[model samples]
Target: MNKPPRKKNPTFGIAVFIVVAVLLVIATLFYNAIKEKREFDSQNPDTQSISSDAASTAAAKPASGAAQ
Candidate 1:
């Protein structure tokens, strides 16, 4: 008696592996860009939040000693 050979599936192959790798790289780049933007915004304060009195006092610190 003779034996028969086994058949392979067409759907399971290397094409799927390459697609997954490309998606992972794009996600990492976007994450790093957003993190840096948050840090930059935190370092700078909004002008509207500071009161008029405090703003004037800060501007006069150097002139106060010289005029008197």
Candidate 2:
């Protein structure tokens, strides 16, 4: 009697592992970015004021004055 060959099924474990690893790396980067932003914001509390001041100064200048 001839024996039948067994069918082989492909494993998705490696693909799953790779996907999880990529997700973990992305999450780590996102967390680090947030942490760095928080630290920078804390260290430079006057950033908003400086930006507002610059905006006010720019608004005070007339754009058409230079052309006239």
Candidate 3:
């Protein structure tokens, strides 16, 4: 009696490799974004206060440059 040969799925391996690469890229981007945001926030601890002060100053000033 003769035996039949088994078939292999080559696409499965390629698909798995693609998925893993995509996941790694996404994770790297997420990590970098979080790190940058943390660094920015730390450097500007009083962001809210500075923004509020700027808003108040702008509001107090005249919108036009004409003399009173």
Best by TM-score: 3
Please give the CA lDDT of all the candidate structures.
0.75, 0.89, 0.92
Error of 3 at 3 (Å): 6.6
- List, residue by residue over 1-68, the lDDT tens digit for candidate 1: 78787686656656677778888888999999999877867886453345876888888788656865
Residue 37, model 1: lDDT of 74
Q: Write the per-residue lDDT of candidate 3 for residues 5-39, one digit (tens) a residue.
A: 87879999999999999999999999999999999
Candidate 3 worst ten-residue window by lDDT: 44-53
What's the candidate order when arranged by decreasing TM-score?
3, 2, 1
Compared with the true structure, the alpha-carbon lDDT of candidate 1 equals 0.75
Q: Where does candidate 1 clash, by residue pair?
A: none
Mind giving the per-residue lDDT tens digits that candidate 2 earns over 10-61? 5677788899999999999999999999999999987776688999999999
Q: Which ten residues in a row have the lowest lDDT in candidate 2?
A: 6-15
> Each model's RMSD to truth, in Å?
11.7, 5.1, 6.1
Inter-residue clash pairs, candidate 2: none
Highest-scoring model, lDDT: 3
| Candidate 2, residue 53: how far the Cα is off, in Å | 6.8
| Model 3 TM-score, all chains together | 0.61
